[model samples]
Target: MNSTGVVLSAGDWRLVLDPHRGGMVRALTRRGQDILRPMPEGADAPFDSACFPLAPYANRIAGGRFTWEGQAHVLAPNAPGQKHPLHGTAWLGNWSVETGEADRATLLHHHAAGPDWNWAFTLRQHFRLTADGLEARLELTNTDDSAMPAGLGFHPWFTRRGVSAIAFTAKAVWLADAEMLPTVRATADTLGDWKQGAALERPDLVDHCYAGWTGQLRIERGDGDIVLEGEDTPYLHLYVPPGQDFFCAEPQSTMPDAVNREAPAPLLPGETRTVTMRIRSA
Candidate 1:
């Protein structure tokens, strides 16, 4: 259970996690082989990197700081030389184990510390392995007596080596400048014609987030295909690290500047926000 932190099983699938970086190594089900896995440390690896929470939200925030409700808040630098805090504070911290069954595990990460973000709150991440596929859910609550703006998303680096055809449909697009921050609104056309799905030939160089997904994503390879869908998570972040063999299909409720731009639903006093996603093998 604690040898290499790699959860493996021959019955259905395997689940791997690196306790140090809070990374998910592998999540496979009966029908599916593995949803997310750790690649050997080397060149041309699909996703040898770690997965973090994009949070407090995900993606990039210019200058690692943002203005909300006329108040300025600065987050610690998660991305160096970029001047922005990324993926929130949970992914880097060791999450407290709440419950771990044979096929499921629930982890809690409470940032009820000092007042930093618009609202101080407690968050919980639930990781589970089911008969269909692996699933993740994020739950957050506003500890403040008033409403606040908070975004949530997951940064899961999927194996892109064997993946050939990828396709999905989204309705909205956030225009950004050189810094990868949302600037204006446009049709999802600029993201390229992914309607018919494109080969994973050159995706690593891309570092952008997309919104208004139809809740279904299709990923096809030579041997297998996968379909991802869910109810709570409406937005998706498409991160392709240049030259790497993997790409990240992150799901979330808001974008980078959602807190400042008011993109998703608004939170009220004692409001709880939840985002969930499911992956079904095809």
Candidate 2:
């Protein structure tokens, strides 16, 4: 499952994982039809992958800066042309295949204390093919001698070439400023009307983290419907870049810049946190 990754198959589903390229899913398909926007041949950037793991923390830390326990820390922005250190650091590092099989695989990434992030930890990503659909799990463990801040999530880009409707219920959405940092929490009434569902087609960029998620949602596609549900995940993040043929409905544990807002409770030494994402046909 390390890059020169493996393809997991079950029924009509097929999953391609590139563990070396930031533990990305190169492709995910059902009956040869793309489920998510697939990574094109020869492309190596994780940004182009079908999906990827977001760990240690979910989204950005304002200006790659935050103060935890009275100590200020700065993380270099990891994404291109972006000033914030978005999507955590795991997406920028390679993972080793800890275990691999025909239908499931677990990849491991160990992060050492550094300027980007202090506190060491291990993140294990497990991918399994099931009769219903695909199941992905992210398990993060605090290996540091002291406590560490941790969060889990996954960023999957669904194919948006045609009409794809989305639906999920949330109490509110965190509105951001020019830097994409949260500035306001507004009622879901004025948002995309997600409670009823809406097509993925839009004219401008839509990036925001929603609060009070119900832990489930559905993507309506022409060929079939994709239902995604998360276990113990309270927040949801959506990204829809204008004029792009791909869209993301991420399941995360914390808000985009939670460290800047209500910081996550520290993970005690030797403690582990896990989150599961399940995809099924509806």
Candidate 3:
């Protein structure tokens, strides 16, 4: 297993995985052109990388607080100057290399019950570069004897350059408050009529989560179009922060702050939940 900047290529697609950098995808390109934002040299954390895995949970947990199984838990703010914990611990920690080969790689992470949250789990991820695109899978198992609530997802930052429009279908949306946490539940078009591919040329920030996603989407940039699909992903999250050169199209298994959601099911001990995301030319 390579520690950093390992490149895998198949046909027109190329992927770079940095196992030591929180098991992040440094870049994803097709035909020598970036399909996702390439992480710059000397870039900071997974936030600066092209893509990274979201485990245990995805998105923000308001004020880093949540209640699970009738017990209250609080997580210290992990991101720079942010009041709440964003994403999970995997994006900021080192991942052990389980296997690395020519067009595929596998990484693993083990979390013990601690202050961050009261749960223990093991996360395994596999990335395979296909002839036309890339495919990845995540399996999270509750290693703890007690039941645990968990979420699985992927975070891919698509390059904003030449980006024209994004198209997807959803039944509803999760509106966010100023703190970037889900607030109101509105129609899919509450932000943009994305059912028909909405142009993203405006300056306003576009950060919201769409529920009831159809499990697929297409991104049309000046370069070309790519289709992204996820299995076991019921929600699609968009984080098009203002003035950024990249935007995120995330496929996740749960809504933000899911731990606090009413009667969330727990992953029983020795139980495993899996999700997958695939990308290819449209």
Highest TM-score model number? 2
The most accurate candidate by lDDT is: 2
Residue lDDT tens for model 1, 1-282: 575553534345566554334434433434344455454443221134434454567666566566655777776665446567667666655566676677667666666545335466777767776655667787887777766667787777677756887788888677677777888777876867777887766643556666778877898866678777756666777766667656788888777766566545556667888878766666
TM-score of 3: 0.96
lDDT of each: 0.65, 0.86, 0.86
Worst 10 residues of 2 by lDDT: 1-10
Tens digits of per-residue lDDT, candidate 3, 1-282, equal 344477788999999888775879888999899889998886757878888999888888888887777788889988797888988878877787788888998989888888876788899889999887999999998999999878889999998887788899999998888887887899999888889888767778988989999999999866778999999999999888777778889999998988776334789999999989999988
Q: How does candidate 3 score on lDDT?
A: 0.86
Clashing residue pairs in all predictions, respectively, total 13, 0, 0
lDDT of each residue in 1-282, candidate 2, tens digit only: 444468899988999999675989999888888888999888989898999999888878888888888888888988889888878888888788899899999989999988878988999999999767899999999999988778789999988864468899999999978888888999975668999998777786888888889999898888888898988788989898888888888999989888878788989999999989887777
Indicate whether candidate 1 or candidate 3 has the larger lDDT: 3
